[model samples]
Target: MKIVTWNINGIRTFRGGIKKALDSLDADIICLQETKVTRDLLDERTAIVDGYNSYFSFSRGRSGYSGVATYCKDSATPFAAEEGLTGLLTNHEGPVRCYGDHTEYSTEELQLLDNEGRAVITQHRIMCQDQVKTVTVINVYCPRADPEKPERKQFKLQFYKLLQGRAEAILKDGSYVIVLGDINTSHRTIDHCDPSDIDDFEENPGRKWLNCFLHSDKQEEESTDEEYNEAYKLTSTHDGKFVDTFRHFHPTRTNAFTCWSTLTGARQTNYGTRIDYIFADCQLAEEQFVAADIMPEVEGSDHCPVWGQLSCSLLPSSKNPPLCTRFLPEFAGKQQKLSRFLVKMDQKSIQSEQRNELPGSQEEEERRENLNPSGAGKKRVLTAESIIPKGKKTKTAKAASKPQGSLLTFFKPKITNVLPSTEAPERQKNLDQDEVTSPQNPSVKGSVTKDATLVLDGSEQLCTSSYPKDNDQGTKVKTPHLTSQPTVGPSDTKKGASSGFWKSLFHGPPPPPPCKVHGEPCVLRTVKKEGPNMGRQFFVCARPQGHASNPEARCNFFAWVDKGK
Candidate 1:
């Protein structure tokens, strides 16, 4: 039997179809990391393959972030499968099984560690030397530590600790373990491209944890008691022994990288670190494994697939695997199709016949005939008497006959009765006398005064603003009608002169910039990394991302928006 592991980056972004890609691998068991699909987004195509059973672990806190899945062929179907490293999920379809001691960590901490959907464990029975042994495969996508976020570094370390604890617990149960996926850390100086640039290459925290976790070949290198004790505090599996299958086979292989940086075209020069691995139990690697290697030539994802072949065949599988995808409700008979919700041809005809045989059919026709008395085809002129019963008197008609007025009457424009200019002088003199003789009233202390409207010719003008002469009395002016010529306002020639220049400056959005190599318009992108240049815009080649050797691939044309401006 053969087992393969790959970080596909995004399962939904596969070219052609997902099944075609899986067939090309030709392995009994395939594990994918960074699936980036939530439970609600899973479709039948990805979930149900022809002869394989699938198990998925989806991220609960985010959609399209971190996820993992495992597909097992019918010949290698597992009897049990469970999601998450915390062993807190109870909804799995298998017998209850616990990994590691849960009393070591609080319930809240365990939930936080498993919320990212990073791990899935499957137990399969395999025959080794005529003895049936249980082999547990743990597929994991470890979190990368962000330098800017201090909390993420802690989270990354906590995940590694929980993973180590569970693997050790499984080992104690007499089951062979195989932990595989993108570990995200280079183990030694030879594994990285430029070891000279990094100070103390093996002194990194993640590397230190890995060194103590794996079983060493030489006894002379086991004197580092202080480092072992530190790793023991973080991961309880410091005593558990496992072998790195790749390095065990090829101890001195160089330029054997499984991942690269597409942003800098690092794959063209083979400049990358060996981070992806398939670690197996020491006894299993020594006894049953035939060959273990990396397939760097495969090119669907930035990280290629790494596989391991076992010498012995799998034990007889059960008739029905407990956690198989075929048993899930999505692939099972529980889900219905669109045709099930629609009415069938026979049902539609039956409903029509039932309507024709109704008892009230004749009475309904007679009622329609009485309503349209003129003719069935003639148009009827609907009147108020027809709409309302003939003997009934509406409240609106009764109110109209009386002198009751409506609210709309108060909003109607009023006609002004213009006073002659001859009487205007006498009216102003009387108002001035009233203001001087009237005593100040305390009730009008805070009242606001407004200017009166004056009529000049046919148009109206407002009087100049002035303070009230007294608190109780206001300065009044009489509006008198005066015969005069129509007066004109200021001209708008200056406003029209500037409109043309403004329209030409902002006609529409500018055309996209063309790339130098392809002579095609470039695509716009924004910086997602957090820093001073975060949220900055840039333009690059429009073609899809591909290797440098591909003739139809994108060119390395990049320009920042600030430089273009």
Candidate 2:
């Protein structure tokens, strides 16, 4: 199967281009980024790609902004909105209620306050026809460059961390995973058209974003400055993980970039760096890895599509093949033609060999003797004894070149370390030496700073009362003074506030209590006693009186939860 990933820039304006890509490329699965249209705004009629099931994960944007969509061919269903990395549901708490102040702010500010919701990364599990194999595909579009504003850069880094966590979890299943989309960070210098132009100073907003992603843990001890610099050279500052796929398919050719600027018009020259990528597990690399750009003539998005094909086998006892893959339209016809040609060539070769060995009549032998008078007259003497040359004994060059030993043996290319340039000393002098520690408030770690201290008081009533109220004119008011107070302990503060203010402030709402009907000691187990779904243990009412038939049930509650082993 072949899968293609492309950032359609804006689906609305480029719907025709997208259609053309789908028609000409014939991707079995197409992962699109920056769709820029919400579910409600999408024109389904035009969005439809014939012979493929479509799924879209649009960002919560109105006009031009981030969004992603995927198209899958075959029985494999596109992830529903609730499934897949892009669709994970994030429950964002409403803005913290600030108490004791009334300040003027605009309706836009009020809307900003309302935008404090969390996002959940959706995960989709695609099961191929053969149930034995499955693969998970994620589409992401990280935040872009905006130096004047640093928050967008920070958001991009944070988004990558979240995406990494999600990816690690999905990989735990041991299934072939393919993550495609505009990751936003260029992993190396080769990934960018102009790497020298990238500013590495602290004031350079993009540099901070790059540093955040490349050094997520801030572990200065783990990586040398040179190592980090080399990583940067291999990755684009615009999108940091360019070398990630290279590491997966090591010893292979390295330059496989997808995104290029049309303004440059350098497509024919191949001068552009690779931005988009298709990353897969090493196990699936051989049978399922391929990447190439869609033609620039395809007037679609600024970015072209890159695709990969996967192949796997199944045994008689196996219910399904051991792999599930997405396909590309560009490869389908070519693959079929190649397979047909191979079979025909094999048959023709076999027929020719058989005809050569057929018994000849006396007339035919005489005709052959006339054609080769010297051979017929002499007792077909052997002029020379053929001997297998040392390396030529093997049919292919690769086989001849390989030394006999374990198949795992491989030639490691010698790597030379290049010294840093003379400008490095000046660049080091300009770098910031101070490290920014996490704020005293843990809540602020993953939240916006302006409202970080809002819910210090643990009392639910005080928390609710603190929220700015709407005045008689129906305009919402802000309480700037309330946020001005220095940090104070719960004991030193006013009465009726809970002592665990820090905990209460960040915890948001409480989760539902465990079901009493299931009782205290319910054991979970995986068993295949009943049927295909039987092994999965679901929470059941442990209380005898809580049984469904019992009218006097002590607790009529039972909630199912996965106690992952």
TM-score of each: 0.61, 0.41
Q: Pick the candidate with the highest lDDT.
A: 1
Off-target runs (Cα >4 Å) in candidate 1 are 92-98, 219-240, 335-527, 535-564
- Ten contiguous residues with the weakest lDDT in model 1: 445-454
Candidate 2 lDDT over residue span 399-485, tens digit each: 557434422112111111111334333443454211111334322111112222333333223322224444446565432222222
lDDT of 1 by residue, 364-466 (tens): 2111111111121112234444568644556657756854454533322221322343553465464431111112432211111111111221132221112
lDDT of each: 0.68, 0.43
Clashes of each: 0, 46
How many residue pairs in model 2 have overlapping backbones? 46
